[model samples]
Target: MTVTDTHTHLYSDAFDDDRKVMIERAIAANVTRFFIPAIDSSYTKAMLQLEADFPNHVHLMTGLHPTSVKENYMEELRHVEELLSKRKFVAIGEIGIDLYWDKNTLEIQQEAFSHQIRLAKQYRLPIVNHCREAFDEIFVVLETEKSDDLFGIFHCFTGDIEQAKRAISFNMKLGIGGVVTFKNGGIDKFLNQIDLEHVVLETDSPYLAPVPYRGKRNESAYIIKVLEKLSELYGLSQEVIAAITTENSKAIFKV
Candidate 1:
């Protein structure tokens, strides 16, 4: 059973001590595909090095993360555009308005989000969005940009049935991760109501670790916990969940 972790920060310093061993552990557990998201230009080198080292396993996305939107955001967006012009990427992603960290930057964040969405449309690539405490704001931008070309994964989706359906209307697949395993993670209550085709699996590692590793650092191999939870929720076997989610991922990433 091949598993795809649609979102993970393999280049994160969290894995610095045992990057190779940690990735190998995930591979041994059948989590072979790792889609890496960009935060800003600073991590670009590290992300590229990760791809160079794990050429077959790693796929990369290019964009300016919402939280990283600051005074030099225009410069950062330029970097994103330059990268897009130079090489191929799976998507323009992990981009959206994040009001949680700093509400003051909402305007800039929305501007960045809209700009990146246009970039994704121009490149004919999918988008991998990162929305946090700004569903209304994110939806507003998505509403303005809605088109046959506007399609991607709502990375780390945690919303109500109405929000989930709204995201689907924009052609986004819900990126289900460790949150589903949490007892209070409300999405689990209504997730099965959504078709499996509209969902994809992720770890968002080295963060949002599943149940057993809740308070601890997360790794790709721990995605199994997420898979098991999804199997239980969807009334399917782990293998089948893995197959369907991986196929859903392929449909989005085109990889």
Candidate 2:
């Protein structure tokens, strides 16, 4: 049962002390494929090095994260453009409006989000969306960018059935993570209503750890808790949940 962590910052400094040990732990638990999302140029080197070290298991995505979109965002997008032009990546992602951090930069966030969406479409790549406190804002951009060519995962989904349906309408697969294991996470309430094929599992590592590890640092291996929760919520076995979500991930990443 190989589980796919669709979005995780495995290259994050949070795991610096024991990165290899942490990854081996995940592999032992059958949580293998690690899709690393780009935050900015600052982490690009680490990301590439990580992929080189774990060439067969690490998949990469290049884009400007919403929170990283600041005064010189154009320069950052140029960095993203240069990478896309020169490398092979699974997607253009972890990009979208994040009003929760800096409401003042909403306009620029939207602009960057739209620009990256175009990049994804142009490259025929899937997008890994990161939306926080800006569902309406995100939907606004998705409304305009809607197209057969625009498809991706709504990373770390935290929405109701209505919103899940809406996200699907925009060609996105919902990324379910540790939040599904939280007592008040809410997605569990209506998640089963949405077909398993529309959802994928993730841990958003070094963040959003599942129940036993909630409020502590998250890691890829902990994704098993998420898979277990989905199994209960969907009335399937842990093995089945892992297999289906892994297959759902392959459908999105085409790996």
Candidate 3:
């Protein structure tokens, strides 16, 4: 079976000491696809270098993450436009409102998020969203920008059934990761209600590790743990889980 890791940061500083080993471990576990999310211009070089180093396995995205938005967000948005002009990216991502960290720049965060969503539409690419304690804010923008032309994944989704339905209404898929395995993750309560085809697997490496690895650094190989949990929740085999989610990812990313 070919498992797809829809969101991972292979170039994260957390993996600097053993990036190769982590990737090899993932590959050995049959996790064949790696989709990398972009943070900002600061991580552009590293993301590109990662793709260059593993062209077949790694896919790159370009965008300014929500938390990365600040006073001079226009400058960063300009940088995003510049990168899009130079080459194609799988998606415009890891972009959304992040109120968990700071609510002071909420206005600027909304502006940047909307701008990037338009950019994604303009480029005809899907998006990978990063929302934390700001689903309402993020949904407001998504509601205004609702169109067949705009759609993508809500990365690391940890919302309720209502939010999941709302996201799907906007043509977005819910990205499931290690949280589904958490005792109080909340997602598991309603996940079974949603079909497996609407879900995608992710690790969000260096963060949100599954049960056994909770509080520890996460790697792509650990995606299997998530797959296992999903299987138990849905009463499906690992191969079926991987196949359906992989197809779900391809439906969104077109990769």
Candidate 4:
């Protein structure tokens, strides 16, 4: 029963103290795969070091996160493009619109998101989207960039069934995470309507910890809580959820 943590930030400063222990704990819990998303040029070195540290277990993606989009967004995008030209990354991702934090940068966020999506298609790499409070904005860009080569996971997806369907139509898999385990998370309300095939498990470490660890810093090891919730909601065994979702992840990352 191997589980995949499709979204996690091993490079996060939150893990500065005991990152190795956190990963070891996840390994012991049978959550072997760790997909790391890039936030911006700032974290590139740390992210690369993480991949080097856990060559077999960690997969990396490069992009400018929406929240990181600032006035100098183009320079950041250039850094991302430079990385894409040099190294091999599983996807071009953790990219999308984020209106929750600041609405002022909405335009720049959209530009960066759309530009990254185009880069993903150009490189023939899957994307890892990070959208928050900006589904409408995201959909608009996705609608324009909709193409066979443009497909990836909607990382940390917490939208409704309609949004889930819309994401899939644009060639994205719904990334289910700790929120699915929360009693009032709301995503569980409509998750069953979507097939497990379109679903992929994640932890989004240092954020959105599952039930037992809610309100605390999340970690990849806590993906078990998510698996448990999926088991209960779908009436399937944890082993089954792990198997199917891990397979779906493999299909996306091609790892």
Q: How well is each residue in 71-167 modelled by candidate 2, as lDDT tens digits?
A: 9999999999999999889999899988888999999999999999999989999999999998999999999999999999999999888999999
TM-scores for every predicted model: 0.99, 0.99, 0.99, 0.98
Candidate ranking (TM-score, best to worst): 1, 2, 3, 4
Clashes of each: 0, 0, 0, 0
Better of 1 and 4 by TM-score: 1
lDDT of model 2 at position 221:
97
Candidate 1 pairs with clashing backbones? none
Residues 1-255, candidate 1, lDDT per residue (tens digit)? 999999999999999999999999999999999999999999999999999999999999999999999999999999999999899999998899898899999999999999999999999999999999999999999999999999999999999999999999999999999999999999999999999999999999989999989989999999999999989988999999999999999999999
Error of 4 at 158 (Å): 1.0
Off by over 4 Å in 3: none
> For model 3, how does the per-residue alpha-carbon lDDT over 1-255 read when each residue is reduced to its tens digit?
999999999999999999988899999999989999988888988998899888999998989998899877899999999999998889999899999999999999989989999999999999899989999999999999999999899999999999999988888889999999999999999899998767899999989999899999999999999999999999999999999999999998889
Q: Which RMSD values do the candidates have, in order?
A: 0.5, 0.7, 0.7, 0.8
Candidate 1: deviation at residue 50, Å?
0.2
Worst 10 residues of 4 by lDDT: 181-190
Identify the leading candidate in terms of lDDT: 1
Please list all clashing residue pairs in model 2, or write none if there are none. Answer: none
lDDT of 4 by residue, 84-106 (tens): 89989999989998999999999
